[model samples]
Target: MATTFQKCKTDEKNKAYPCASTRCKHPWTVRYREPGGRSGRQREKSFPTKTEAVDHGVKMENDKREGTYIDPKRGAVPLKVYAEKWIGRQHMATNTEGTYERAFRLHIYPALGSRLLSAIRTDDIEQLGRDMTTAGLSANSADAYLTPLRSVCKAAVVNGDIGRNPFIGAKLPKLPNKAVDETQLPTGQQIQDMADEFRPEWALSIWLMAGLGLRTGEMLGLRIGDFQEDHVRVSRQITRGKAGQGPVIGPLKHRRVGDWRKIPLPTNLRDAVRAHVAAYGTGPDGALFKTLTGTLVAASDYATHFKKVTKLLGFEWSPHDLRHWFASTALSNGLPLLDVSRWLGHKSINETADTYGHLTPDSTGRAVKVMDVAITQHRAGLVLDTAA
Candidate 1:
């Protein structure tokens, strides 16, 4: 049950002044218990008139009885507070977690962090995306940047902090074609030119990537024992499993522990690995390559040299481009798409075809030939039947 009463007002001097029933003109205060009748916690709110106060009190009691009551305070929590907690609960790679944290700090916090969870409107979210695009990020990049916030809002809905996610059906900016552009891939001579910029050990690493179509992390995680005369075993990669911890030896991308794949070793690649082994011996635990100081060749450390050489060579390319070059070269040389996918250790053959199908050797010519053969056979049969 709820009761209405008028509370005393304060003067400009910050002193309480009492008001009698005859002269009382203060707002009405509604005092009531929470959902469970007398057992529910006592709560209070004030209204300008007796009627509004009575209506709000009745609605509160009924909503609680129906088990649909959401604490007004829960929705008042700041988005930043909730979002930080959300990040802590996610099971993600260290680097990815780091990226999300950086994005939230730089992009989200300044704009909508102070807003209450219930107050964050769909307009605010769509506006944030536009702001990112105006700052020169692609529409796809902006969308990715908003992923953590979008997830946080959805989780809030489930937690009963808000009724619905503001992100649902919002009009975000459009993205362009995402298919791989073969022009970004480096050529054979360009690969060698960049390789020559590194010392022999690291140079061989570049060649292994291009020849075997292996990821940079997979190449860095190689062991001397993994190399054979005819093939190489890919079993692990250097990765950071948890946020804040440095990279460690982890399973390959898109693979579970103990899963492995093997790629055929061409004669030239085999000779290159042998030459590297002969020259520098090997790092601890049979690691095929490492820094001069014998540390695991980390991507951040390796990228410094890669960037310097690419800048000097007057070309913009990344280590992964070497892998793309290998796939393109193999596809152009008549290797089957399925074989290329296997060589690259892709999760599926369709993945390889989707990215590099345009590079398939003489695809248009082969289609034309097939069509011509079908037409000629049909016409020949028709002519023979007419003659008979």
Candidate 2:
């Protein structure tokens, strides 16, 4: 796959009796190409010394045989270019795509975007994370900002754009360990109190998030068609785009198109939906919540509204906190953990447990009491058998 040679300068008669350093600035050159389909792709790199040239040539040949060969020159492609291409091929959700792009533009691009993919070492990636943290971002926030870089580097390695992923086996910043508090959740009455802070059109946001455990985007993306008397179909969300662009409807997090899950519509939430529909008559796209001018509600727009409501009520809870209250209330009331996870649209039961697993101190006492009752019943059955 590669060869090394010395091209010494000839004399005036176009003949060279001996090679010498004085005659040529870079006499040694490594000629390399991939295997089989490497035709017309032959390229060369000049080196100051024969040993350096030959070493690189051998490594290239070995890499080709090992099936991990990439055009050494192609690795020079800027990270931003490769990252854009990599993200484009991924077909990610709109919000996720926007996050990746924003991460690149704000954090990663300025530091490393122009650097060659081949040149970025694990140390550089780790250092960038530290720099972001030192720049006042929390450890978790820094890691979140670096996620796009980590993913892009990983993909580069998989696609052979680079030899290895810098992120793999690298020590990354960790989120601070936190003790879960069950009291973080709000009560149904508390939710209603917050709902009263807004008009019916916007009040439904609080109900859906608190009552149904809907995510902010999912709540904003709700439409009349997605709602039934008995159940609600959760299939899409509102996702932000580039800075100046408006949010668009996209598939639910971690789900593909045409995939949906039904959450049972409770009697109260169902009645609330009907009242709102009767008053507002739905927006142009049958959306349950919208502005007065018949436009789709964006998550950011509603976030601003929620901040105002929190200021007014002094409840100090977010829309997401309402969803958390839904989960906490369900779990505390004996709802199966797996069912709670499903209703919250969590990716896995483990996630639900990690976030909402903390319960009250009396929970274990309740478990023991139930066990006592079971044992008593078993003893009674044994005595009845003996009597028979």
Candidate 3:
């Protein structure tokens, strides 16, 4: 597209004012043509002076040649408004949407909401990180807050609303190691005791979690129809949406809607499930575990019951600790790492290995013993050969 610079004439006087008029706020207008059908439409903007207008028009031409021109007004939208539109466009799960919305409300909006997309700077991002740290947020929590912000900034860059992401290279708190510290995990005995102590009505669910490594969400979302004679299918999960909205049922994490995993049922667990079913009919939603009111069980309610049971048993652990117990027990019992990973519904084998690999029993002593036996056999064969 072609570009030009022109002087703006005073309408009443019908006279073109010279550049550098202290009184004339908008003395010059830069004119350019945009790409359009048949003799593209002309677009223009006013500047403070003719020289400045000409420079801007030439820069626009150069930018057009390089395919990097972004209209200055494109990023005039505030961060909060742009973030809201961006969030709306995403086809995320209900819980994920709530998480992003919560992040925006609690982290991004308070610090950068009113700032225009184009006006945000790297220092502003750094300052925000510092503020979050000063407010006693962990590195992981701060990064969680920054995640949606980074995604939105990248989208803005892609939409040509901003030249680049200000937070791209900004300093953030260093995340700690990702390994699951087994020291915090509950022992198998503790798990068994907790399960044994649970009210008969909730005992089967507790046993399933401790044995199968299923997430709390997956366990609560289970329905009677999802279970077969030999195995149970994991197709959906439940999660709490923003604070007061309560638990929401949705597809399993890292899976498409309607996708599922089938886990082989243990004989004892199947019997327990059968007994539980006989005592308590399916919930209104056909859920295997339900409250007295026949609604699908809420995780918080389960936790309350679990805490009460553990306290009575003289121990304490989150429901998720049951899954940890399963992973450690399975790995110790010679189950293949890959199978354990699938049973846990992990997105990748590496994730499973990173979390539980260290928990696998050490084999250095066994390795030495095996090597010693091999060496002894080799010497015995040499001695027999020589004697023969």
Which candidate comes out best when scored by TM-score? Answer: 2
Model 3, 288-369: lDDT tens digits are: 8877777777888888898888788777677878888888888877788898889899999999998888877788999999
Q: Count clashes in each candidate, considering only residues at least 3 apart in sequence or on different chains.
A: 0, 0, 0
Arrange candidates by lDDT, descending.
3, 1, 2
lDDT of 1 by residue, 228-258 (tens): 8899999987754344455577777767778
Better of 1 and 3 by TM-score: 3
Stretches of candidate 1 exceeding 4 Å from the true structure: 1-76, 93-102, 105-114, 130-144, 154-162, 170-176, 240-244, 345-351, 362-388
Q: Which digits, one per residue and each the tens of the lDDT, describe model 2 over residues 95-147?
A: 78888888999999999989988898888888898888888999878988998
- Pairs of residues clashing in candidate 3: none
Candidate lDDT scores, in order, read: 0.82, 0.81, 0.82
Per-residue error for 323 in candidate 3, Å, reads: 1.8
Q: What are the models' TM-scores?
A: 0.71, 0.79, 0.75
Total clashes for model 1: 0
Candidate 3 off by > 4 Å = 1-65, 196-200, 242-245, 304-316, 360-388
TM-score of candidate 3 relative to the true fold: 0.75
